[model samples]
Structure formats: structure tokens, C-alpha cells
Target: MSQSAPYALPFHHHGKSKVRVGRVWREGNVHHMVEWNVNTMIDSDMEHAFIKGENTGMTATDTQKNTVYVVAQRMSQRCTVEQFAIALAQHFVRTYPLVSKAKIYVEQKPWARVQQGGLPHDHGYALQGTEVRTVYVTYDKAGKLDVTAGIKELSVLKTTQSGYEGFLRDQYTLLPEVNDRIMASTVTSTWKYTSQPPCYDAAFNAARGALLEGFLGPAKGGIYSPSVQFTLYDMAKILLDRVPQAESVFLNMPNLHFLPCAPVGSTFKNDVYVATSEPHGNIEAVVTRRTAAPHVSKL
Candidate 1:
């Protein structure tokens, strides 16, 4: 908002690192993640006058652009997406006193670096999916602050293990039992930490590890699941229980259907149907509370 004049356009430049991705798979499942980085630049006078229209000393859009690039350059190598978010939030607010508010958002993309032998290549990588981590920050002149971060496009599955029972059945049911079959889903999982972690690597690693293990491992053979919904609850619990910094986990899973296939006469067989990834089941929960962890930061 520009305050110099009712029509004053206090200049601010914005840029975001869009559509970045990374992926790694362990034991037959593919894992992917994404992120987007953003920045904004506004000169002091322009900032001070956005609401007051006092654009006497506004920074030019060209300068703002240059500044964004400069900030990006300064931030690219050393900052985590969260730090970059914090920097972006702090930068414009301090730069412009007129700026009553500022916001920064980072969205992550899923991808995998091609492995040479058994490990990821030194520098080469590839995008996997549209899912991502989302981070948002906002600051107000009143000293109010907000920050949120989470993951995306977390797909998972296991063969002949998970189940979906206790739903209504109809007369069009020519379908067979689903007791032991492949359960597949392309999931979007997000968990927002209440605060920035002192150790970003540790928090990220723990979340990633728990997600992988939970998706791949069925906790108990028979006692673990009453249904898919229940299983999702368990998954959220595991994530909350295992990941320290996160205060909550949100999961969006698209049930990807595969042909119910079986072997016959020593050959592969297909149930013969097209698989789909839409009209997904949505699950959300608070996995942790800020009171539980001293290291957890406030939003």
C-alpha cells in the first residue's frame, strides 16, 4: 500500500526461486520434495510512504529488481529456505517504514538426483512432481509476526499390506476382496513448525526419515489398522511423535489405483483398468504441541 498519494505507487520489486525439486527412493518407493524462494526490495522512502503516499525517495523498479537479485545471490549458498524466508520478511519491513506489512512465501518441488551406482550424483538431479514444501512469513508494523512451513507431494505405497475396509458396498459389486494387494497413493504431506529450528538439518532429516519409514512399514500385522482412515491417523501420530520441531502435520493423499494384478500360469496378469489420481482422501491433524518441546519456535 502506498500512502504518499491515494494513487501513489510506492515501488517494490519481488522475485521467487520457482519450482525447485529433489528426490530419493529407498527400497522400491520414489520420494520427492520441492521448494520456492522469494524476495522483495523496497527503498526506505517508498516503504515509509506506501500508506502515506510520501513517495519522495522511492526506489526505482530497476533498483528493486537489482536488489532482489543481489539478495538472492547473497542468500543462495548459505541460507536454508526458512532463513531466506526470514530474511525476506525482515528486509522489506526494515527497508521501508511505510510498509505496514510484508510477506514471504517459499514452495518446494519434488525431485530426485539420478544415482550413479548407489548414491546421488555430485551435482546432477531431476524433477519428480508438482508437490512441494510451503513456507510463509509475515510481519506487521504492530510487531505481530507469523511463519509457517510444510512439505508436499509425498507419495507412498506398499504391496499386499495396507487395507481399506468397512465401507458401504453396493449391488454393482462384481469386485473381489482387497485383503492382500498393492495400496498406492500420491500424497501431499505438510507439517508446519511453530518456530524455526536451531538445527534445520536435524529437523528436516527426522521428518523425512519418519515419513519414509511410516509409509513403508506397517506398524503391526493385524493390530495396526482398522481402516485407511485409522492408518492415516497412525501415520500422523508417528510423524508428530518422531519429528521434534513440527507442531502439526497435514496430509493430502491421492489414491492412485493400479490394476489388481495376479500371477497365472507362471505369467503376469492384469485386472485390466486404468489407474487414476484424483478425488483424493484428505487427512489433517496436529501432531505436536509447542509446550511439548522447548526447542520449538513460536509462529
Candidate 2:
């Protein structure tokens, strides 16, 4: 009888991560800039590297990091984060015959042009808080492609017009129901495209606008949010409606609690709150069109 292998190499993938790059393009006196943190991973048949320490088929993580900068340099001035991710994914799979599949993840820092008097400055920029635009793309040698775009650290809050009630009570329950309360969350959302959009920047903007509109309702009178779950569903639904190319939307909105506090020898009138980040509620869901096929996200 032939000797059998001691261990099975069931699955393996390797790449570089957190490769930060900043690219600037100049048009006369104006300049445009983008900063991205990128990560790359590739799936290939490299069992020998694990079993026998053969390194011929392995792609170095440093090489993967260089590839990100090289691809970014080749991109056009108008390139979006989604486009860069797709290009990087395609490059790995096409360049290396052993690479069967490649996945690229990118996060863009929000930087807006600063205003000089009342007009936008030509070359001055300011970081826009903590929010970021994110993109994930995967490509295979067989021409399979998947793309997802999203927003991260999108914080929103409303003082009133939100409440939580009618929860399942147990013997250990100590919370009380209220008709008015502060609602806040740091939203992290992702939406998978059915196909590549013509303009990724436009598609992202539209989806973000829909999410904000759905959450706040209108400028005059905001909509009442009965629960975080209800608001999450509505946000996803609105995004799908606004962007036809998006097949599905996934939202992760944690309830950042603002507990009401009363002053010394004073009655509580919902006037004060003790904001807390930890021990908060987590609410998330996926919304899709009725006819759209189900999507299995790798995020």
C-alpha cells in the first residue's frame, strides 16, 4: 500500500494588506487627490508550497503591494475606487497563470475641497470626518466578476421622532417603553451590483443619497422611526429603488444609545442624555428585489 499524506491542504490564500497609496492629478492650477487603503488576496493551486516548501508558484506579498501602486498609476484621473478595485483584481488573475481567483478590497478616505471665501478652493482640501467609501471586487480566470460598494462610519442621529416599544419581555427585563427617544447609529452598508455601472461615482452618490433620505425622511418633518429594524429595512429598500443596477443591499446599523439622565432633585423630561457607545444594540438586515437572485456576499 502507498503511504498517504499526513495532512490535507484543504484551502489556502495569501496576499498583502493595508497597502496605502495617495495619488494626485493636476489640471492647470486645480488638483484632484485620492487616498486609498487597499488589500489583495488570490486563490491558487499552491499545495506544494505548504507540503514540500516549494516556492516557485508563490506570489510574494511585497509584489502584491507593488502591483497596487502600479495599477493605481495606470488608472485615469477620473477613476473611482470601484474601478481601481476591479482593475487590481483583474491584473492578478490575468498576470499569473497560477492565480485562479483574485479579490481586491479598497477603502477611500473622504476629502473635500475647502472653500476659500464662499467659493471652493482650487487646491486646498480638508478631510471629511471619519466616513469612508469602500469597494470590493473579485475576478476569476473563467471571466467571473463580482463587485460591491459601500460606506463606512456614516454617523447619523435624531433627537426625537424615534422610539422603541413592544419588545418581548422576560423575567429579567428591566427596560421601559417610550414613544420618544434619541436614535443614532454609525452605519456601515454594502450593496452588490448586478452588473458594472456606467459611472461608479454617480451610482455611489445616488445610493448614499437614498439611504440618507430614507433615514431622515424629509427636510421639513423627519419620519418617525418605530425601531432600528424598521429603519434599516427602509434604508436598504430605498437604496435598491434609487439604484437599479444594485441587486441587493446589506446594512449594519448599531443603536448608539443616548440614555436619558435627570439632574439632582429634578424630574427627567428627556432633556439630558448620557451617550454610551458600548453595550449598544446591533441591528442589521439584507434587502433585495423580489425578482433579483439571492446574493452571497463575501464581505
Candidate 3:
């Protein structure tokens, strides 16, 4: 390695408009098709991780969009959002030479024109534990393709049913204690891909299942349970294990607290549930990969 190039690789930009159809509903008692459109524009920072003069082999826009079209065409019959993304990205690097890798990012806007009618021909609502999906793709000259997807903004809760205790105490630990308190949050979680082939629907189901089970599992009622930290780790680990594509999981939970009510008629204020958003605790832990190695393969 006598010398690396002194210049930088310029950006490679590509845009695509993709549409998908589904048997949205039996409108007027007859089966009809509904369409979802995803339009995306991608710009790769080609020089960011590269040696300057090596940029001659980088990919171009035509090739990138061709990959997008092929991916979406293949996914016209898919059943899960995550699955669609993974497949699209995988085909890109597997096809092009200049593209030893490519990044696939999509922006899906509502296409059911009926929103102007309050409710359209076929309509749906976003619900709790339901979220928008995103993915990052990576590939290397060694012929590795990684597809990582996640559902963000999924909501979860425990009704005085989840709690933690037995943490070692210290002199500065004047924290109030409650045997049973509410646990609720807008949860954000992510999982990286392993070597497994992408099964968007299967991985989606497993991640959701693991999130729910880990938070609500009977480990407390089971044996050798430690603390809330343990529960979080368990939830993350379970997700990685059950979803073969998942290599590791990272979780961030902000312990949502509701303020205690002040009783007007009675002289008691300790037990009522008056609510206020904080000024609260933020808990974060990485459930795997203690050492910082390349996460390139997992996207």
C-alpha cells in the first residue's frame, strides 16, 4: 500500500417510483385491487469510505434504479413490509459489478386516493405496535450482502404488572420504591441481519413477538430473575435468536412516569395517578457485540 488516492469519489444519485397492488377489500361486495406507491431517491456518499482513485469501479444511477425495479417487481406478491425491503436490496449487489454494494431506501406515501373521501375505497389505520419500516443495505467485493430492517415507533405497556427490584442499593439511592407501578412507552427497537436469507414477514413477526414476550414474560415468576435491565436484554436477545436474519439488537426505553395525583377532599396525594411527562430516565443497552467490529455485513 504505497499510496491511496488523494481525490474523493463523487456522489451517485438514483430515483425510483414503485407501486404495489393488493386485494385491499371487497368493495361493494366485489374483490377490488388497491395500490401502494413507494417513491425513493438515493444518493450514495461514494467517497466517504473509499480510497480516492478507486472510484472508477463505483456504480451508476441507471444500474441502481434497475435494481429497484427488479426488486419491486419481485415483491408484488409479498405479505410483509420488511420482507419487501430486504429482497429489493439483496438483488442490487448480487447483480452489478460496479455495484459491489448499493443502498436501498424507500419513502412510502399514502396512495389510496380515497383519503379525500375521509375513508377511501380501501382504507387502513396505523395501530399501536404497528410502525413504519426502514432498511439499510451493504455489500462488499467479497460477495456478501446484508439487509437490515426495523419497525420504529411501536408502542408497548404494562398495567401495574411490570416492575423491577433487588438492585443493589447505595447511600445516594433515595429513589422512591413501588412494588407495582405502571410501565408504558413509545418503544424504539432495531435488529441487524445475520447470514440468513431475508424473510421479511417472518422476521417482522418474530421481532414483534420477542418485544412483547420479553417485556411481559414470566421470568419474574420464573427463577433467577435479576432486574429490569435483564428483561430488556432478554427481550433483545430473544429477538436476535428467533429471527435468523437478526445478528444483534439495540433497545432504548425511556421509563415513562405518570405524576401522582393531589387529593383535594382528602389529605392524601401519594397514591393517585396524576400525569405529567418528564424530565425522566433514559435506559439504553446493547444486547450483543461488546467489541466494535465491522457491522458492514449486517447493514
Cα lDDT tens digits for candidate 3, 35-145: 333443443445533544454644555555555546655654534444555565556555544444445544332233334365443444332224545455555546566
Weakest 10 consecutive residues of candidate 3 by summed lDDT: 290-299
lDDT of each: 0.56, 0.90, 0.56
lDDT of 3: 0.56
Q: What does candidate 1's lDDT look like per residue over 117-158, in tens digits?
A: 998765556777554655666766676666566566666666
lDDT of model 3, residue 74: 64
lDDT of 2 by residue, 1-299 (tens): 12484767689999998999998888889889999999999998887787778889788899999999999999867689998898899999999989999989899999999998899888899999888999989999999999989998999988988988999999999989988999999999999999888999999999999989878889887999999999999999899988999998988899999999998999789899999999999988788888776565444
TM-score of each: 0.64, 0.96, 0.62
Worst 10-residue lDDT window for candidate 1 reads 19-28
Task: Indicate the TM-score of model 1.
Answer: 0.64
Off by over 4 Å in 2: 1-3, 293-299
Regarding TM-score, does 1 or 2 come out ahead?
A: 2
